[model samples]
Every structure is written in C-alpha cells, then in structure tokens.
Target: MITAIRRMFSSTIGKFLALAFVVLVGVAFALSDVTGNSTFGGIGGANVAKVGSEEIGLGELRDRVRLAYNQARQDQPTLTMAAFVESGGLDRVLDQLIEGMAFEQLATDMGLGVSKRLIDGRIADIPAFAGVSGSFDQTRFQSFLRENGLTEAQLRRDLRQQLLLEQLAGPIASMPRLATGMAQPYAALLLEQRRGQAAFIPASPFAPATDPGDAALQTHLSQNRGKFTIPERRVIQYALFDAASAPVPAVTDAEIARVYKDNASQFAASETRRFAQVIAPDQAAANALAAKVRGGTALAAAAQAAGLAPSMSGELTLSSYAATTSDAAAKTAFAAKRGDVIGPFQTGLGWVVARVEDITARPARSLADATPEIRAELAKNKANEAIVDYYNTIQDAVNSGASIEEIAADRKLALATTPPLLASGRAPGQPGYSLSPELAPLVSQAFQGAAEGEGQLATLVENEKFAIYAVKNIIAAAPPPFAQIRPDLLADWRLAQGQKIARDKARAIAKAVEGGQSLGAAVAAAGPNIGSVQTIGGRRGELGQDGQPVPPEVALLFSMAQNSVKTLEIPGNRGWLVIALADVQRPDPKSIEPARVAAIAQPLAPAFGNELVEQLAAEAKRRIGVTINKKLVDQLRQELTGNAPVAE
Candidate 1:
C-alpha cells in the first residue's frame, strides 16, 4: 500500500496535476473577478459540470482552461486563446478535472480521509518549501500561499482531497507479478525461426520497348495532373540580426582575473589515488583479506586464498571513487596515506578491501592558463546583449513602417531575396535553396499566403534572433507547362509500363511454381529479366539479409505447411515474390531458458496493471453515473472560441 501511494505521487500525471494546482491558484486569484459568476445561457449557471454529487464550478473550469491555454502557448508561442479553445483544449482540461472529481467522490464513499498530520507531513516533505536548513519554514509556506493567492484553509482542503484520491487509485495501478506460463508462449513465438526460398522480379529489369509518343504523354499528364502540381511558393526578402555578426566587446585583464577568482574551485583539479581492491561476498571475508594485507601479505595472495578476484584501479578521484564504489569506501580511501590498507566496507557490489598504491595532489591552474576561455565567454555574453539591443531597434523601425531593406542597408545587416521556390525550399532540377538556420521560420511565414508587400516579424532561434520579412512575390501552385515537364512525363510513363510487365511476369512465374516446378526452375524459365532466386533463413523478430524485416510474404512461409508455395505481391514496384516454405523451427519447450522468458515478461507487468486499472476506472464511472450539460458545454465552447452556437 505504501509503495502504491509513493508510485502514484511520483508519476508524471501526478506531478503535472500538482504543478497545475500551484500555478492555477495564483492565476485564479488574479483573474477571479474576470471569471466569476459567468453564465452560458440558462444552462451554465454556477456549475459547469457535476461528477457524482461534486460540482465543478464555472470559476474553477475557467481557471483550468486558462492554465491549459498558458501551457499550449509555451509549446507553440504563436498560439492564441481562440486557437487553443478551437483545438479542444478546454474540453481536455474539463475531462481531466471531471475525472479527478470522480476519483475524489469515490474516495469519499470509501470513507478514505487524510488526517491533519499527514497533510502537514506532505507539505513539509516538499523541497520547494524547505529553507537553507532543509526543513519546512512557516514563513516560507505562508509567503508562498500569499503569492499564489491561496488561503490556509483552501490549501488544506486541496491537499486533503489529493491524498484521498491517491489512496483510492494507487492500489489499482500498482504493478502485479505475471506468471511464467503467461509469457512463455509469447517468448517462443518471438524466438521462432524459419527458412524459405524467395524470388524477386524487379520492375527496373523490364523496361518498355519505347517511350510514349507526344499525344500519349499529353493524355497521361492530363489524367495525373494532380501528381505533378507544385505546392505554393514564395519569394521572400529578409534581414537577419545575428549574434555572431554583432561586435564583441573587448575583455580586460581585470575582468579575466575577476572571473578566475570567483570560480577558483573550478580551476582547481581534484586529488586522485591509484588503488588495488579485493571484493568479497561478506564483511567477514573482506575483513580477513584486509588483515592479511595489513600484516604484509600481498593483495593478490590474500584474494586467491579467500577465493575472490583482486583488481587494480586506475587513478580515481574522490567523486569517481564514490561513483564506482561506495561513499564510505571513497572517504576511507581518500583519508588514508600511501600503502595503507583500508575498507571491509559494505557497498552495492559487495564488501570491499582496498589499498592505496599511489597518490597525486592536483594544483590549481594559474590565471594565465585560464585567460583564453574566460575571455571567449565574456565576449559571447557581450555579443548576445548587443544583438538583443540591435534587434529591438530594428523591430521598432519595422513596426513604424520603415522597410526592412532600408534598415538592413543602414545598419549593415545581412539582407537577401530568395528566388521563387516551392514550400520545400527547392526548385525542380535546380540546386536546393535554404534559409539561414537562424532565419528558417521566415520560410513558413512567407508562404502563409501573405500579400506581396505584407511583412511580419517572426522569432528565429527562439530569443537569440528574429527576422522581419516581406513577401516579394507569390507563386500559385499549378501544373507546369506540358513542354516543361515532357522529360519527367516520359520517364514516369515508361516506369508504369515496366511495372505492368514485371507484374505479369511475376504472375506467370507464380503459376509455374504452383504447377510443381521448383522455385529456381520457375524463375529460370521466366526469361532472364526475372532476377536470381535467393534462399533466406527467416527468423521471427530478426531482419533479413536485405537489412529489412523478412518480407511479409517470406514471414507467412512459417505458417505454411512444409513445401507449400504461395505468391504474394511485394510493395514499392519490387514486384511479386513466390516463397516456398522449406522448414519451420520451433523452440523446444524443455530447452527454453526460464531466465530469458522472465526478462521478456518484466516489461509487460506494468502494462497489464495499467490495463486493469483502466477497466476498473471505467467500471467505477459507470456505477457512479455521470451527467453532462450539453447546452452548457456548447455555450462554453462558443464563448471561448467565438464560434456560432449550434441549434439543439
């Protein structure tokens, strides 16, 4: 029960809900007046929803929807409140809140309640509320409540409800042990292997006798015009304010020295020691080995006598030692002098006995040695600040109606106009064109059907850089002229002809093999265009020789009776293949390794548990019954999105 409770509170959903509660509390206080008592017709009175007897008030729903809106904006900075609402963000938040209320109601019916002490302990355990002494501070807690606009009573109520929900739901979701019999069949299937013979008839080998004539080409182009139509393209003119191009301020000697002084520990190297260790299964064995080493016996001899392996460690710093061994062992090793025998301390690996062979004390690097790195860091910081200031000035000018080109020329910033190119940033049979990495967002904005003189400021590379671009021209998507695409049309026409020929040849070969001819003999009789027949040992869950999964046709070979030949169409114009099942290999039950089956089953336990929990939750919801006001929901959606309401 304790484990389940801990797991619940540590889960991703739990953490997100906790964070949302904290964030929404602050937002609710600030927006309380704006969201309070808002009604949607007569249906959306004070309550937006009712899960069991618990009512989700209009104010609470608004706060959750607002929080969801803010989170959406973080993922897509250009997303507006209307876009979020239209994307069903409000519905999703309401669903989560309703589910939470259902769980709370279930907990109440179960008589699951948390005491004041438990709530206090939970709050004290939160690291965010801890002081420098690593204990909960009353002042800090009260200050947090004030900042987030949460009263003590409100916070206690929320915490108590959350605990109750966790107590009720945790056990259902806890991982359960799966039996070996449940997983062995799957393991055997995954390990099953088969061998077969396959023949591939490729389309490229069977080319058409001649290219289609001009009239045929015209007909093909008309019939398949959509395939050749180009996507909309745009010609864009953009100006970039790059940090790399910004003037870097010179760093002074005093500045370098100050940095070196402030970060003195970083410049100092840690002391390291070479160690020889003997690991034993228990402390008694480890202690005996240590005593032998201290009494002048060699570590190797002691280990051999104790039936343990002796190993030598390279130069290990205190941090490395703690990582490789245990903190207790590392502390003992570091405090000892050269040739001192230490340990017999317990670690995750085993009980360890170690001897220090050599020690090296590291000295700090001089200021002269660290000057180059410090200078580069300082210069980069200055350049970043300069670029930010430069971008602000350019953005202000652009907003005030001064053209980007004029500002670029005056400020000597990089300004360029791209040739008309498709949305993919390329033109047919031409060198590919691409915007600068820092200005890539300009391409999307440019093709958003902006009018020829319209301009917009878009963030590029996040806060580091931005570009203001204007659409120089728009290229409507349409089929190119027949004469312009004649070569492509001819090639595609021939490929179609070739694919038909290959399919026909494959069918003939399949017929021959079905008539009792060997696969190799059938392919040989089909003319030289049909490629060589290859035999593959197809293993379930293993790739074929071609670095792909054994083709689906070949995989079906295992299910066929011995020597059965089946014809299946291969995808991607690779043509059809006839696979002859030569052998099937099933793993012997008695020879199956229990350890391997257990390894495969380990990851499946949590999935089975989660499935059970979903079923249980669904049943619980059904038993409790849930009623939603469709009119209120529709009205809320219309209000948030400014869409016309649907007639009932």
Candidate 2:
C-alpha cells in the first residue's frame, strides 16, 4: 500500500490535485522494517505494499518514480518541483505505484519466471556495456549499476522477470500480405528504348466560352453542395505562464567564484592533436603499424615505407575522427591522448596513428551567476499554476451546457471563426486554411463530437499556454443552391474540353513520331502555342504520385502502367500525361528484406503492448480486484498541474 502511494503521488501539479495521498499511509509503512532492494517483486524503496512474502522494494519504486518524473518534466517543462508535488505528482506517483505492484503481482500469480541466462544475454546486448575494445566490459557494467542505485544481481533478476512477463503476452499480429496479382504490372520491369515525339498544348492559351442559367447552376450546386457550409469552430483567449518570464535571484560574487573553481576543468579548452595515419587492411595489420609508430619511426615516414598512403601531420580536435566524419579513408584516426603515442586504431579505411600536442579546456559557467536566472525561471514556473485552472473553468462551463458565447464570456475567452468550410473537409475561401496546422484538426474534431448546439468543448490543450475550445455552432452539411455554383461548373467544364483537345494533339504527335516524324516536326504541326514538354520520374501512391500523396484517389493514379497515356479528370482539376517507361529497378532481395520486415513489424508492434496491458488488467482483477479509491483519483484529478480542470 505504501509503495503504491509513493508511485501515485509523484507529479508536477500543485497541491489539492494529488490530494496528498501520502497523509493516508496509516503508519503501517513506518513500523515495517524491510526495504525491498533485492526482492524480485520490489519497487524502489521499502516495501509499503506486499502480496504474500513478496515486497515491492524502494529501489524499484525509485526507478519508477524517476521514470515518471522524467516523463513529467518532458511533457510539462514549466512544472516546478513544488507544483509537481502539489499537483499531486503524488497521485500519478500513486498510479504508478498501484500499476507496478498490480503488474508485478499478476506476473507472479501467472507463474511466469524469467531466467538468469536471458537476463545476462539482454544486458550483454546493450552497447553501453561494451568496452572501447568492443567487448563486454564488466567494469563499465558495474559502474553503470552503481550509478543507477542498483546491484547488478538485483537488476538482472528483475529484468529477467520483466522480460519474461512481456514475452508471455505473445505476438498479437501477422504480416500484411501483398494482395494476390497486385504486383503483376510492377513485375514487368520494363526498360524501353523510347524515341517518341509529343507536344503540350496549354489549354490556358484559349478563352473558354460560358453561357449559364439558374437551372444549370442549381444542378451544379446540387451535385457539389459540399463547398459552402460554415465550419464549427471556436476561439479562446488563453493565459500563458512561461518560465523565461520568471525572475531569477542574483547569485553572490563569492558563490560564483566558488562554482567556477569547483568546475574549473570545464573552463579548459580541449586538447588539440596532430597525427598521421597508416591504413592497414585489418586490426592485426593495424596493430603491427602501431608497433612501428612506437618503434621511433615517424608516422608519415612509416606509412610511406609500408606502401600505404602517407597522410601528412594534421591537427584535430580530440573528438574528431576523419574516418567517422567526412573522410571515410581516414577512419582509423581514433588515437589521441595527452602526451601519449597512440593508435593503429582500425577503421573502415584501415589503421591510424596519432599524437596529442595539447589539451585546451573550455570555460565553465558558475552556479552563483546562474542562480538568479534559475530562480526567476522557477518563479515563472510557479506562476503557471493558474493556467490549468482556467482550462478547467472553461470546460466546466461547456459541460454544464453553456452556449459558446456564454462559455467565452464566463471565461473571458475568444470566439474565432474559420474560413467557409465544406462537408468534404476543406476551407474553400481561405489561403492554406483548407489544410492549416491547427484549424483543420480543430474543425474536424468539433464536427465529430456530440451533436451541433450543445457544443463539445475539447480538453484544455495548448501549444504553449493552456487552451480549450467550445463549439460555437455546428453546421449541419447540405448541398448549396445551383445559382451560386454555376460559374464554378462552367469553369470546370471548359477545362475538361481543353484537356480533350490537348490530348488529341499529343496522341497524333506520338503516332507521327512512331511513323518517323521528328519530335520538333510533330510539335510544330500540333500548334505553335504548345508549351515545352516536361519529363519527370516519380512513383505513385494514393496521392497520385508520391509527392502528391494525399487523397486515396490520387494514389490509385500512381499505380497505373509506367508508360501508358492516361487522362486524370479530378473534379475542378484536369490533367493529361504520356508515360514512357525509362527503367524499372527492383530492389535487391537480400538488402530489402530487412526493411520490409521492419515496415511490416511497425503496426503489429503496438498490439503486443496493448495485449500486455489487457493481460495485466485481467490478471490483476482475477487476483485482487479493482478498488478505485475514487476519492483519491478525484482529488488527484482536481490538482493536476498541466491540465487540472480539463480532466474533470
């Protein structure tokens, strides 16, 4: 119970949100003396919650707490420790607490046991555990464990169980099968030697005729009413609480000097190095070159004698490796240390030799000088405590059936309008408004929510400051009147005519070229007004071509025959193209298999996670059942820092 509470309460929100679950631990945690460092069921600290003889340890609890803390920091950077504590970082802390104990308990009950060998193998697989020599480094492994507050043995045992629990959930998906016969056209892999002639008669050159009537216009409107409805949109004025706006207290001069002295090494410029390299075929050959380097021969002279490229002595930063940077041939350059004759490091290009001439360290920033800025930053973070409350009030007003204007007035928020929206998800009258970053998604969600008038207010969301929206008015979609749409219809009709005329001309050119007329001759015969023909290379997707990937209809266009002459007639858009297959290159089977496998695995990947969640939930219910402690959850929700009121 104590472990669960600790895990639940860790958050960045101010108090009342977390509701201080810690105040309710019941003194049982204090009296119990076992700290769960080694137990397989342990969390981070002393076991406050126990299932049978198994206890959730302080170490595991701490790990989960740290992970949650880091995540909170990332998700809500302005969160101050005080706000976090108040917002009931404690409740989130508690959620994690309950979740961890529950999952651990469920895994135990299922008789799932992880093996030591598997744990060892997994640890060995980590790149961090490898030494500079590229072998498993026991010293580094031990150091890493110590720093993270874990004993290697304890970590191994827990990791084993965790992996086993995860694996037991099983794979939840299968590969996407390429539909039968879909690859038939693509399999042709045509490489045609084409000598073709074509002319592009720009339809824009001629004025299109227009004679319209209400009857025709109404027909057009009836067919395309999707173009005129007003979108359901809301605008809200939000408060911003920024950390940069906060004032940091000044640091004392003495403190600043002390901080600088303490971190003097940081102020030093890094070492500058000079080295010459000898590219050898393998590590053994590289090692031989290192011996030569050490045996009093100049690195460049030695390389020349060894029948390798004699790279002249050059200066480099300690971190720079030419082989690892721009020059692949100089990759063996990993040998530079203070006054040390280093290397014959093996790289893609071969072996290298280096000598360090000097170490220049960088300057350090003192804590005293930075304290005021830090404190000001802290103050701004604290100031943000009220923003989430604002989102909450706005949401509360909407949930209680307030009108858009009423909600906006109550919260003193803005009510913004969008460009005239269409039923097909477009803003017909505004530039880029049809596909704007924020407005588009916002409009779509507003329509998807609970029916028109009793506006659905979204969670207080913000790119920076907290934001919430109340649907002002939901427009029920209907076709527009024909009188208002005739002009558009005529414009579209004329373009279609022009494309037909242009295509006929292009076909004649293709046929003439086949009959031995020069491309220039065919184009001249088609019309003097024809524009230059353009050739491009592209693959098709739902968006017509990869570059135009958008609508499902367009993607179909890309799948058509490589060189087949096709006319694409989109409503309001007319285009024609003559495809001449230049080449079709199939990817190498072995090289592309891995990429395909990964692509297939991506969507299937999340199923395992979902399965695990469900499995644990089921197991947990079967074992101990759920008791929401609704009061606690509610209290925690009330105090959430980043988004308190919205959750309500």
Q: Over the stretch 487-524, how does candidate 1's per-residue lDDT look in tens digits?
A: 98887777666777887877887678778888899899
How many residue pairs clash (N, CA or C atoms closer than 3 angstroms) in each of the candidate models, in the order given?
0, 70
The local distance difference test score of each candidate is 0.68, 0.45
**Model 1 TM-score, 2 decimals:** 0.47
Whole-model lDDT, model 2: 0.45
Query: Which candidate number has the best lDDT?
Result: 1
CA RMSD, predictions in order: 12.6, 20.1
The TM-score values for the models, in the order shown, are 0.47, 0.33
Q: Model 2 over residues 1-648: C-alpha lDDT tens digits?
A: 122333333321111112111211211111111255532222234343453345544334333433343334333423333345565555555544454445555666778777677777867766545533345767556544443344555555445544644544433212234332333222222211222222345554442576556666556544443343232233322222222323334445565556556656554444445554456777776677668778887666776676777553456653565535334323333343554566655455655555544555434445655556555655455445344344445545655666766665554556565544443345544556544344433443343333345544332233233334444444433333445655666775566567666667667766765566655666677766565654444332112334643542233223445334433333333433333333334443334344444443454434444544555545664575544435434433343322344321
Candidate 1: clashing pairs of residues: none
